[model samples]
Target: MKPQLAHSRDPEMKSSLQELLIYMIFLTDLGILTFGMVSTDMFYLNKVMSSLFLDTSMSETGNTNFKSIESVDDFWKYAEGPFLDGLYWDASDIRSSIAVNGTTRHIYYENLLLGVTQVRQLKVRNNTCSVYPAFRAFMKECYGPYHYLSEDKEHFGLKNGPEWWYFTSQSLSPWHQGLVGLYSSGGFTFTLPKSKNASIDKLTYLKEKGWLTRGTRVVFIDFSMYNANVNLFCVVRLVLEFPATGGVLPSWQIYSVKLLRYTTYYDYFLAFCEVIFCLFIFSYIIQESIKMKILKEEYIKNAWNWLEILLLLLSLLAIVFNIYHTVEVSSLLEYLLSNSFTYPDFYLLALWQTRCNNMISVNFCFTCIKIFKYVRFNKTMTQLSSTLSRCAKDIIGFAVMFIIIFFAYAQLGYVAFGSQTDEFSTFQNSIFTQFRIMLGDFNFASIEQANGILGPIYFITFVFFMFFVFLNMFLAIINDTYSKVKAEFSVMPSREFEISNRIREGYRKALAKRKLKRKSTSQNAILYAVRQDRRDKE
Candidate 1:
């Protein structure tokens, strides 16, 4: 039954209550979406990738001949560090593993591509030097003008290896390829014949060629590590874009992945739920579009409306990608199932699926933000909203000033300590390292040691301005606005939600009707008793 609104006279209140009620129905769909998120991306995909985790440097796992990388000093140490170490297996192992005892009918593979499109010698030092330490052997020493970690030779022991490499651009990307060279795949050191007059290190070679990133900066550690008979393909792809400084532009993706199913029952059920969720989003979009048409300018003006549009766009992209991947996977699998000898090239599909998951995460965040719009009428929430909006202009001004000073300090630290300290090795690293210093993860001794006089001066200025002055000023602005909002809300009496008021009104009327019926029944019983008493007296 449609409930009556308490503030019937206020048409605006009535309309808002109606809208809130409709939104509640749409909110039910989030339950399924959340389940899919936790089940698939958070747990399931991690499990699949984890199952493939191994130390590629070890003999048990296949090896990589890393051509795309610039440095080889700590390559052995790196091939085993964080995340899974990618593997390279011959096609025979892949085929034999799946056909004999494998529950997995098919397998797919992808190369572990590392580095930005533009590879630099400095970045090679930055990425590796301090990241993977062997022990108390003191790995941070690598973060120096000189790679001093080599002095701790007992810990840094894959010692007898290439001090340099040559970059030969691959006119072909080896997606259908795995590692070459010997076991442990160690020979990246490019050597010239003894007849030659001169030899070049990796750094000298890149400099002479005039550094380019496209093919040389990246390493594709390919994997066909189809574990004896177990099924999995695992690798990582990551790049941080700096815009004039960075933006991650897309490159061609390889279709070298096979979709996995842990259990057929859950897979089918979750897939069905995904279809339902997508359909609900489509319906919700149509409803919101109608409202958008009715309230054109106002709709566009509202930030919450834009969030809805973004959520819908992300959701739409995910849905379209999912459909395309499904069709493509099915077509490929159909051919593969028949032509059992053929290796699968579904890597491109896997890459896009991962990207799709990232968008799902964005959609989830926007969906959560949209919740505030529906709950804005709440007294506490209204105060918070008012406080933020009131100080928004001031905050914006503060933010601009903050960025200028922050960049100034970051650049200063980068230019000063970048040569000797890992924390300030790159402009971006300096920016983030400054943030860490703010958060109290600072290494003061290192900062001071980077340069005795300038180091201390730079830090003192950064702290005094950023932490002591700007931070407190920003906090004061927020505190002042909050106090004003609190006072304003306190002066105006609060009303319960219109939907809650309607439900209470229905409950009160039902209670009154029940009491009236009981009263009439009691009177009727008393009259019957009185007539019985009169008959006994006669």
Candidate 2:
């Protein structure tokens, strides 16, 4: 009774263990799927952000403590004052008027342009009040100010002399043809006012006219410039900061500015769903890893197992890097909001995130490859496995011979044709080109260009040997092995079950052979003893 109970309990334990293992495997699969979904979502979000940000035309407005000066009255307020005494001021005779209610007095200041230029030039000058300090900082941090200036000069060649080159060649577009001619041809300058009295009067008058407003007023300035080859129309915004008090000196600032691109609600929702999915995948990977009973060294020996581990590791790394990037971006944005003197440099974060996303995408591909292991359980896949396995040794031996000759040809082609043809640029490229030719992507013209007559001979001979002869040999080996494996598998009930049964039958036959040998030895011994007894009787 006790033995029966023990046997029953043992079976129950085995069944429970099997059930647990199944549950774990199921959970692991679920987790992997979830992570896959998460990775896809992240990729989608990245694409959306890239597209939105790349489209520089998309803009959003925000209230800033910057001033806007739309008319001559606003400019005169700062220009006539003692504020100009310390700073250089140049005005242009190119007066333009925009009909707001009536024609508002708009005078383009060349001195203002000079002032902006000088401030930019004086990199170490601390006293120079810049309206777009954040912009300057952002540019300086992301791309050095000098480098940015140099690039601008190089992009738009310095034809109109160094001092006025940037301003003159800045707008390259047919749309701003008249405006560019107006600004370049005529402009005015005024030295900083020696006293504050004159500037105060102008400010007071402008204040009375309701031009002096609190915070910043952003004005979009459009212009066009043409280089010899291309015309570019550009827009720049002016940030004007006017203080509440009339006597205080006002701020004038100009720098390149960009607005942060906004993301849609759908993007956020998708990201949220992805996060949940990724969590599940992460959990499953961890559990699967722990359930592995093999030693680390032994576990890594299996290619599929190693791949699984690698996928898990890369996913984790990607997730960690992404989290860090998100945090850094959020922190940077917060810093920008708190201190307007600083701006967000999303380049570093964007680049880092892009790299992580790319790695995750690769992991997803590998995961798909890993799924083939399960597919191999099918009867058709089993036959494929057997065929491939049987052909593997022969293929490996052939590959060794093939690689030597292939590389020899590759090197020869590279040395002979590298200078003349783009295809044979390097040994690696030569090898790839040969492979392409084998696949019927042969470019006779390009090959002929390398050595003319010799090129065609070399290409024809190489193709004849490698593609027609060697490749056919490779295919023949595979085809022959595949046929044999398929025929053998066809005779079997099931590949796996048949193999196990054959092994068992072989074991039983070995035991039967041993038993028969023992029986024969015993019978021979008895006959010998009986003959000895007869001799003794005689």
Candidate 3:
């Protein structure tokens, strides 16, 4: 793209140099501030939340004992103790409007929550599987609990692949049919009214449904509660993975508490940062639009054009997401506040906010990367670009060969060890296992135990071919390309290298209207009167 300037004040400086200088100065500041906003919002939220739930604070609340809620009894311990105490504080802002004889009910939890009293005394409350619509929808679709893309995923609570929808729904067997906490994607979703009890009622129900028994191997439980204190819903996930065949009751359990917060002060600042980045986006759009008008079909040939397009697309989405997050959070928080006594359902909003955060992160990354486009004047960056461009075809071919060979090995590994080895159980797992093997994270013993004869042969050959051969082949391709690029750059200056030199020449030209305008080596005229008479005579 040609950088054009109208009515040049300085005769020395090129238009491109001025553009790069301005672009770098303005865009880098904007990107840094935007990234900081994202980070700060998360940091503040986490800090406050940690104080409420972690370490010493939780110990004070008597919740430390039941922190790892891997079983039904552990959760009951938490609910009966700190959870009830927390509700008293959480409901402080939303105390009941209902009155007894022209006076507000002084019974806090009973008045604030739908039910917490029996015989004019506070009774322990119950917990239930989440009734959040989006959560149920996602579960109905048979999607698992966690979001991270991983190879070693275990859908301990939800149903599994190919047959997830069927086995989860229509063809569901007795044991897992109404498996209590998490059954189908529909799950054990019950109205969290007075009926939904937090005690071992669900476990008993699970036992009745054949999901839990004396000989059961594992069970996973997930539930949520509303906190009006922060206007956020916290979800608690549990895993009861201890051995049950030892004639002892399952004694080991694990739990994690996760929550997404409402918008913070920095969220508004983030919106401001979005607008700042918008200016840069607008500038690029104008540049690209002008180039497209002039170049027409030829504009499609430039890869930078595509990067600009992608950057603009992400920027637009980020702006929309920011707006969505703010508006949705405000409205949802209001709704949740009014209904603070009931279970809060903010799953979709949380998902969207998380998705928005992820987008802004990607947008900021692209914003930083966009700086490279303006700074191609640097020799090393130029060489790196050249090397990639030169080896693009070779790398593409190499990637194809690598995937084919890699997939072949993955399939073989799955066939040999998938049934017994957890890492090799799924196709995605097999691929990740191969990658991990190269990284020295694989368990050779597990592989051998899975299939004694094929295990050692598979491990050795996979390492020999992948680690020693194809992987090195890829590196060699890059090394050779970079060497050629280095030699070429050594012989001839890049087109942009002239801009760097021109920037040096335009140092004084770029002074603009600053106090030190156009630096001069001119001498000052020192005036003297009577004192100069002796000097003049001399």
Candidate 1 lDDT tens digits, 61-173: 33432222124332333333322223222225543433321212222232221111122111123222334545536533332221222111121113343323433323222
| Collision count for each candidate, in order | 17, 26, 6
Name the TM-score of candidate 3. Answer: 0.61
Q: Quote the positional error of residue 91 for candidate 3 in Å.
A: 12
Q: What lDDT does the true structure give each of the candidates?
A: 0.52, 0.47, 0.52
Candidate 2 stretches greater than 4 Å from native: 1-265, 291-298, 332-345, 495-538
Worst 10 residues of 3 by lDDT: 119-128
Q: Which stretches of candidate 3 lie over 4 Å from their true place?
A: 1-13, 37-271, 492-501, 508-525, 528-538
List TM-scores for all candidates, in order: 0.61, 0.46, 0.61
Ranking by TM-score: 3, 1, 2
Ranking by lDDT: 1, 3, 2
In candidate 1, what residue range of length 10 has the lowest lDDT sum? Answer: 178-187
Query: Which prediction has the highest TM-score against the true structure?
Result: 3
Candidate 3 Cα deviation (angstroms), residue 273: 3.1
